[model samples]
Target: MSNPTELTHAPHRDDVGARMGMWLFLFTELLLFGGLFLVYAVYRHEYYSQFRVAALELNLSIGALNTVILLTSSLTVALSIGALQKGQKHLSVMLLLITDILALAFMVNKYFEWSTKIHHGIYPGSEHLLNLPDGQILFYGLYYIMTGLHALYIIIGLVFLTIVLGFVITGSVNKDSYVKLENAGLYWHLVDLIWIFLFPLFYLIQ
Candidate 1:
């Protein structure tokens, strides 16, 4: 049988390993987005005018509102972790719940935004899009691909946050052992960071 003392130390090692693993996973995500950004840059250089026109068709107000939502959600995640570290479990859970709400708000806003676009026949592979010039077609193509991927990431992050919230409530993550919460926070931040890049590239281009 394993020594009781050794068993006690096992979680410490596991915590370190978990953190390293999360970082590795996030690094891979960055690579994926980096490649997409490079593609966007290449195409934008060739179709700057078309890209600008397509961007103008996007609703800046909705994009800006989603940006604020994600930024606020990131803040709540940070605060949740801090609250847990300070042994305020209830407060931590509350903050995490707030983060979840903000995430859902972002998604709902995106839903409406996408619906509006699609209603106007502005989505990928639509007849209207295909009828456009090559440059304009490429612009909408990248916009959908990038923003759609970002929205998927947000959903994934929401799942992670929800799971971590349960762990926190059940004491699986606590002040003494909160590696799981930290990992979830890292993932959420990555989701937010990707959007920070996406919002500018797709919505605020000159």
Candidate 2:
């Protein structure tokens, strides 16, 4: 006959292991973005003057607004995790919902920015860009690629946070088992951090 106490005490999941795995995944993501930044730096150094001109075409107001939106979202997500830890389920869910809404707002702002650029005949393969000086062309090219990739990351973060919200509602990620939400928050913060780097590089540069 099996001992009931031993059966009850058996380990079901390793929260530590799960967190370690999440950190490993985040490290890989960092490496990917680091490589992209390296390319941007090399190209920008080669074409500093033209890069400044290309940057002027970007709307600093819109970029700053998006930066505020992302930073606010990061705060909400962090607060949500804190709420969940304190066993405040409703508050946690509401904070997460706000985070998701902020993410959507960021995307909307990005859409308008891109639309304006495209309307001005400024895209990756537009003849307008091609005919520009080589330095300007390279600047615009890197700008589009980096910003596009960051926007994709925001979309992905929204989807992941939505799933985590669902989990929280179902009580699967409550105070005792909040690893899922924690991991999701980590991902969102990463997206925000990348934008912090991007905003200054592409917008505030003189």
Which candidate wins on TM-score?
2
Q: Tell me the tens digit of each residue's lDDT in model 1 across 88-206.
A: 99999999999999999999999999999999999889999999888889988888898899999999999999998999989978887898999999999999999988999899986
For each candidate, how many residue pairs have backbone atoms clashing (under 3 Å)?
Answer: 0, 0
TM-score of 1: 0.94
Q: In angstroms, give how far residue 69 of model 1 lies from its true place.
A: 0.5
**TM-scores, all models, native as reference:** 0.94, 0.94
Off by over 4 Å in 1: 1-12
Among residues 3 or more apart in sequence or in different chains, the pairs in candidate 2 whose N, CA or C atoms overlap within 3 Å are none
Consecutive 10-residue window with the lowest summed lDDT within model 1 = 3-12
